[model samples]
Target: MKKLFQTSSLVSVLNVSDYTVALTWYSAWLSKPDETPMDGMAEWRIADNAWLQLDATAETVKPSAAIIGVNDLAACRTVLLEAGIAVGEIQDWEVVLSCDLHDLDGNKISLAQIISQQ
Candidate 1:
């Protein structure tokens, strides 16, 4: 049998009342202001090629699964903080520094940077 492929793509959706506003913010956050928007959904492409989407019909909930790892933890944290999205404080794991946050819909979003071999 063929071995399973490495990690594929990811798509995460969050609900927001102001889809346009959310789109603008996400465009800046992802550094892709020209990114397209479809109907009630706006998407951001994370570093790992994960799709982070915002939908108008979604309801607030704890995320079942959502996270984005970055090369510069401190810088990423700063960006989120500057955008007023950082939740609580930065956490230090055995091999990473991470922050757990939520979007307008309350879906969990994590930003982390590796500190050592995992």
Candidate 2:
């Protein structure tokens, strides 16, 4: 298997210092960003080639994490707490049913829901 440059798209970047408060909390927690090609960056096309970039780093030095894989983690945490986003509460992590979030430069998001009969 020697194919290393044929891959197309797959972005997963999460680095924000302050691009207008991370574009207003990732555009209401990953909503209005189908594309924003430049100017601090914000793109979300999490499928066909996969993407989820929200990069605007003047460079800090800590707090950075990401884990998003949700089918229905309590209805996406109730639509990210009704667009006010402070989502964290849906534990029971035996396999996967998790929740934890922290934006506003504290970047430590997680939203998992994968317990399909295993």
Which candidate number would show the highest lDDT if scored against the true structure? 2
Lowest summed lDDT window (length 10), candidate 1: 57-66
Number of colliding residue pairs in each model: 0, 0
Best by TM-score: 1
Q: What are the RMSDs of all candidates, in order? A: 3.5, 12.1
TM-score of each: 0.69, 0.33
Residue-wise C-alpha lDDT for candidate 2, range 5-100, written one tens digit per residue: 787876878888777777777777666899889988888886788777887854653667878788899998998898778887899877889899
Q: How does model 1 score by TM-score? A: 0.69
What is the lDDT, from 0 to 100, of the residue 98 in candidate 1?
86
What overall lDDT goes with each candidate model? 0.69, 0.81
List model 1 lDDT by residue over 1-118, tens digit each.
Answer: 9768887777776667777776666665676533457677767776466777777756653334477888887777787778765555778887888887765555677888888773
